[model samples]
Target: MNLWSFLQDPASWVGPDGIGARIVEHLVYTGLSLLIATAVSVVLGVIVGHFRAGNLLVVGTSNAARAIPTLGLVVLVVTLLGTGITPVVLALTVLAIPPILNATSTGVREADPGAVHAARALGMTTWQVIWRVELPLATPLIVSGIRSATLQVVSTATVAALAASGGLGRLVVDGQRLGASGYPEMFAGAVLVAALAIVLDVALGSVVWGLRRRRSRIGRTAAELDSAPAAEATPA
Candidate 1:
């Protein structure tokens, strides 16, 4: 069938329900997977990032997670959990955690020691030093990690369709079942996935940029405060 004919025949892309509904399903599955994965990884990463005791543990765990092959991990989860959204979510979360943990740990460990020391000198609590000094400096690296994790989750969520969770991957899988004539549908699914990745990456990147900008402003304000004359030294 021609591209025009395929477009006109809603069943090709949308299945029997229609294009809008299928698109919503694709987005819902993708969005939920990413959201859950991001939340879990970021929280775990941040907690692990804050202390020396947890550093080795976080690094070791993240490396192990990275070593697991995506398909193999998904298969294993499916075998244990049976086919459904939960197993797919668990698989994507596993794929996502490594980058987040690694980046967050690296960033926190490499945060500006001078600023951290100064915060400590001022009698700031440990949590204050972390929140005001370490986390700000580490924001960029954490953002990078999040960006990587988000992209990975988006790509892997498509595989969830294999377990009967509807997603854009249904188009590709169904097309493959129908043979070479279904190539266009497969290509279309690929295009949608690519577009989704790009959109999410750009959006997360903007958040990182904003964090960096805010950090810069905070640094400038701190510098100005440091240079200001002591209030008690002013002439009476």
Candidate 2:
């Protein structure tokens, strides 16, 4: 069947028990992997970003992780852990960590040194400087890292189907096994995966944009507060 025929076949993707359920399952797996990866990577990144010595270890580990090919890593995990969601989650989580850790560390390190220095000069504790000054400034970069990790996880999670965890990739693999006429089915699966990735990227981007806007508004408010006394003392 051609693309149009595939599109017209409602039963193919939307019946009571069809590709739709599998797609949802794929999304669930991807989401869970990303959530776990983000939590771990962000916390580790923050801790490493706060200290000079730890930063080296974080960067080195992140780089090493990124160097491991996704397919190879998936195969290795599957071999060790057996097939199903567990192996898939483990592989995807490993794939996601590097971007998050790198972005978070970069953001924290790039935060205004002057602000940090002033906080320390004021007798603020190390934790206080990190919590009150460094983290706020690093929010944008940290969010960007999350967005990157999320996109990676969504795309790669499809590989889970290869290990017997049903997903859009299952449709592709099964269709290919069925021969040339199965091209439409494979194409449909690819299109669905791409669409899902785009939607996720766009949604996460909007969230990051919202966060940046809030940060900007907060900065403006602080500026206005700083100028308020000067304005009041000036001639009316």
Candidate 3:
């Protein structure tokens, strides 16, 4: 089959079981996994990081997560749950959690101590200090974790197609089953996966850029205030 044949086929782009449906399926799996991972990991991470407690637990969890293979986890869950969205979402969420947890914990722990102390000195509550000073400053690395997790989830979600589920990966799996005759279809699927990954990554990066810019503004404002008293005292 010609590559153009599959690429040009209007049928592939429309209808209930077409590329559009598959893309939507992929997105749902990815979005759900990211949400679950972020909610669970970030909360725990922030608490641990803020209090500086359970360092060993955080490090061990991160390492353990890294050691577990995503594909194996997906397959294992599917075997027990027997197909459908549940197993897939669970597996993907597990896959997405580690990096996010690591980032959140590290980011908060590493935030400028002066700023954190200043917030505390101002009578800000623990929650206020975390929300205002820590989170804003730690945002860069947190976003980095989220972005990494997003890409991981998107990639892993492809395995859903293997379990008779819908995703862009179905194209590759189906095409491979067709052998050499399906190369064009397989190529098309692979291309779509790469393209989707790039688009998502760039989108997340843009958000990070905006956060960093805001953080910089806050930093500059604080610096100006610090210099104000010095400037007044230095006047001839």
What's the true lDDT of residue 17 in model 2?
Answer: 36
- Per-candidate count of clashing residue pairs (backbone under 3 Å): 0, 0, 0
Residue-level error in angstroms, candidate 2, position 138: 1.8
Q: Write the per-residue lDDT of candidate 1 for residues 180-203, one digit (tens) a residue.
A: 998877776677778888998999
Q: Candidate 2 — worst ten consecutive residues by lDDT sum?
A: 218-227
- Inter-residue clash pairs, candidate 2: none
* Candidate 1 Cα errors over 4 Å, as ranges: 2-19, 224-236
Q: What lDDT tens digits, residue by residue, belong to model 3 across residues 1-236?
A: 58778878998789876778888988999999899999998898899889999978987988898789877887899899998889999988988888999999998998877677667766789999899888888888899999999988888888888777888888889889999988987888888888899999999999999998988776665556555567879959
Clashes of 2: 0
For model 2, residues 1-236, the per-residue Cα lDDT tens digits are: 88668857888877533688878888888888888988897677778788855887888888899899888998999999999889998899988889988987787777666666666666789889788777787787778887888878877877887888877887788779979998988888888888888998898888888878876665565456556667879996
Q: All candidates: CA RMSD in angstroms? A: 3.2, 3.4, 2.3
Error of 2 at 204 (Å): 1.3
Alpha-carbon runs more than 4 Å astray in model 2: 15-17, 114-125, 220-236
Give me the candidate number with maximum lDDT. Answer: 3
Pitting candidate 1 against candidate 3, the one with the higher TM-score is 3
User: Could you tell me the lDDT of residue 1 within candidate 1?
Assistant: 77
TM-score between candidate 3 and the true structure:
0.91
Error of 3 at 131 (Å): 1.0
What does the lDDT read for residue 174 in candidate 1? 73
